[model samples]
Target: MHIKTRLTILNFLEFFSWGAWLLSAGAYMSTTLGFTGVQIGSVYATLGIASIFMPPVIGIIADRWIPAEKLFGISHLLLAGLFVVLTSMTSFNSFYMVTFLVALVYMPTLALSNSISYYNLEKEGLDSVVTFPPIRVWGTVGFIIAAWLVDVLGLKVSHEQFYLAAAASVLLGGYSFSLPLIPIVKNTSRTLFQRFGLDAFVLFKNKNLAIFLVFSVLLGAALQITNIWGVPFLNDFSISYKDSFVVKHAVFLMSLSQVSEVLFILAIPFFLKRFGIKIVVLISMFAWVFRFGFFGVGSPEGMGLLFLITSMIIYGMAFDFYVISGSLYVDKMSDAKVRSSAQGLFMMMVNGFGAVLGAYISGFVVDYYTANNGIKDWASIWFICAVYALIIGVLFALVFRYKHTGEENLVIKK
Candidate 1:
């Protein structure tokens, strides 16, 4: 097979593994297993907790001892077994523990897959910047397809999602071993701190970078709210709008967010050049307000349906602008030597600390809004999320300082 074809398949299965269970898991636990909001949130929080330290630790191992491809394969194989185990878990404690273990083994492969792709692309003498996006987009396609399959097969609330994910994990894990080898590079000069990317912590001395990172954590808290609740929120409508297409196809409707994500990514360079990163990021912050507000008011009927769709569309801007643009900003401002570690730090703040905060707090809000009948007040839940985003945006505008020159440009370097 051609190198691009091979790498595309790798990227496809990589996200397919995640999409199989991620968005739908909350609904599964809520509707099928009768778990509480906090319980569901705790389950999802495992991903954030594992993300906090596992990736960097795995990266160190991949760097100094094992090849990236081998490590990636090993991780996925373990994930496959864990997914099988996850299907049998019913109690909250058992489920949370297994899910956390699954996350610890699975989260690192995200970075490892990227490393494998970049290594192979460079080996083939391809410019990754130009070539990789097209390949990576297939990951999104895989995610969408997996979600659709789960929805159409009526497996969204079934343990079958884990089974499907396990099948994909096994396929990807085995295929990984056949990919081009990624030689481990042993750098003797690097100290333990540098090896673990702790050197990037020095960037905190800059007030602006420090503030940006802190807010990154705050905004990151918003990132998983939809993933953990969007399906459940939509699924709730089955009580009132049982025959409605949105309820019947909630995961499929939510998949539009990923579609919007692809389209919005194309617009980032233009927005970055015109408004610069600060304004662009500010636009993202407010977009989150609208994103959640729309969800707060939307329903399965008439104008409410439009609101729901609009929320999904806005998701693209809300996500890409903050994450992609913020990464670019970090890359541009940091010294080249610490640039990689700086990027790691940004992810740590957002996906690690931010995710953990969002998961638990949002779960609490969900539980708070639930009445004695166990019915959730989704509008209140979403309004609270919108208000949180609005406060973050306003505060960010007032406190975080960055002056954008008219000469701003978007240049993604390898």
Candidate 2:
């Protein structure tokens, strides 16, 4: 295979593993395990919890000890084993434990994939700005493929999805070994017992960065709310409207969000350059408001379809701007020695601490609003999320001031 083709396949398999379960797991919990909102939150929180320490630590090891490619391979191989175990789990505690273990192996792959891609791109003499987005977009396509497979193959909310995910992960794990070796270099000149990628901690010292990280945690809370509840929400509509198309194809329908993510990502350079990162991100924040609020008010019926479409469209901004743009912003500002660590730090806030906190709390809120018979109060749940996102958006606008530089300005309009 051509190097780009090899890398593209790598991207596809990497996200396909996630696509198998991430979006559809809500329905599995709600319909299969009969878990409450808090229970769901706890499960999703495992991703956040693992992300907090795992990514940076593993990154440090990759930088200083083992080849990153080897570590990446090992992580996915571990996840493949865990996914098999997860398929056998029938209880919440057992399942949560297994999922947590799976997360420790899986979540960091997100960061690792980027690291690998960045290294490869630079090696090939391609600008990440121009090349990475196209490659990264395939990951979303992989996600869509996974969702379709689960839906069409009738694996929704079943162990089969995990089996499929396991197979892909194993394939990717072995394939990782074929890529270029990422060497680990020891730094004998360093001090004792400092945290892995600790330079990210200094971001706390910058006022704007402190606020950004703070809001990142808060917004990160809003990020997973839909994933934990949306499928089940659509499924609930199935209970009353059994023949509704939404129920029949809920996972496939939700995949639209991922599909939309590609287009939104393409728009990022324009938004970033034209308006600057601050406004671009703020627009993304408000986009989250629309994302959740539409769900609160929308239905499978006529104009509700518009609302649903709007929500999906806005999701591109809500997700891409904060994550991709935020990463780039950090890159533009940080020095080379600590750049990787800084990126890991931003992820720790958004995906690690933020996601964990969101999942745990959302579970409580979602379950609390759910009635005695166990039907989720999706409207109320979405409403709460909409409000949370709105508040965060408002606060972000008030804080974190920055004027776009000339170089960044050129990048955007180009």
Candidate 3:
């Protein structure tokens, strides 16, 4: 098979494992397992907790000892076993422990998968910028398809979603061994701190970079709110709109956000070139405002449903703009020597610290709005989220300062 085809399948199954359960897991925990908001939030926070340090640690192992492909395969095989273990746990402490372990093994694979792709693409003499986006987009397609399958097969509310994810992880893990081997680069000059990418922390002295990373954490918090609550929020409408398609196929409807994501990614180059990074990121912030506000006002019928659909569509801008543009800005601002580490730091801020903040705080907000009888006030919850996003946008516009040069370019370097 062609390398491109092989990489496409690799990317597909990579995200397929995540898509099988991420959005619906909250609903399952809430309605089936009888977990409280705090418990569920803590469970989802495991991703952020593991993402904070594991990727860099894993990167060190791949850098010094093992080939990237070998490590990638091992991570997934481990993840498959963990997912299987997840199916058998029902207690809060046991479930949280297993989920955190799964996150530890699984999160690093995200970086590993990208590393594997870049290695193979370069080996085949393909321009990664040109060939990889099309291949990578299939990951989004895989996510959408997985979500739809869960919904259609009636697995969204059952442990069976974990089974589906485990099956995909097993296949991906086995297939990874067949990919081109990534040779480990032995660099003897680097210090222990440098190996862990801790050297990038020196960039904190730069006022602009410091401010931008601070906001990255704040915006990162917004990233997972919908993922954790979106399905359950829609499922709540089952009481009012029993026959509505939105209620019955909530996961399918939520998959539209990923579809929007694929489309918006194509537009990022143009937006970055024309508006510059600051304005582009600000646009993303406001998009989040709309993303939540629309959900606050939307229902499963009439104009409310339109608001819901609009929220899903706006998710593309809210997500892709900040993440892509912020990464580009970090690349431009940092020195070339620490550039890769700088990017790692950026991910740590947004996906790690930011995600943890969002999970706990959002959980508190959700529980605060719930009555003693278990009735949740979703509108209040969503409006609070919208307000938080708006505050971040306005504060970012006023406090963060950057002069945009028209010469900025978006380059994806491995």
- On TM-score, the leading prediction is 2
The TM-scores, one per candidate, come to 0.89, 0.94, 0.91
Selected candidate, larger TM-score, 1 vs 2: 2
Per-residue lDDT tens digits for candidate 1, residues 1-414, read 999999999989998999999889998999899899999999898888887877666766676577778888988999999999999998889989999999898877776766666667767888554566567768877888888889999998899899999999999999999988776654554577766545557677778888998999999999989999999999999889999999999999998987787777667777776777789889999999999999999999999999999999999899888876676576555544444345556777777788899999999999999999878999999999999999999999999887877674333332
* Candidates ranked, most accurate by TM-score first: 2, 3, 1
Clashing pairs in 2: 37-363, 38-363, 273-412
> CA lDDT of each candidate?
0.83, 0.80, 0.83
Residues 3-27, model 3: lDDT tens digits: 9999999989999999999988998
Backbone clash count for every predicted candidate, in the order shown: 0, 3, 0
Q: Please write out the lDDT profile of model 2 over residues 1-414, one tens digit for every residue.
A: 655677788889999999999988888887788777777889999989988988777767776677778888988898899999999898999989999998888877877777777677767887666577677788888988998999999888787899989999999999999999865554653645333445546667777767887887888888878777778888888767788788888998888888888897777767777778789889889989999999988788888867877787778778988888776676555544454466667777888998987888888887788789877688888888888888888888887887876365221110
Greater lDDT among 2 and 3 belongs to: 3
Instruction: Name the runs in model 1 displaced over 4 angstroms.
Output: 1-6, 115-132, 180-183, 190-192, 195-197, 328-343, 403-414
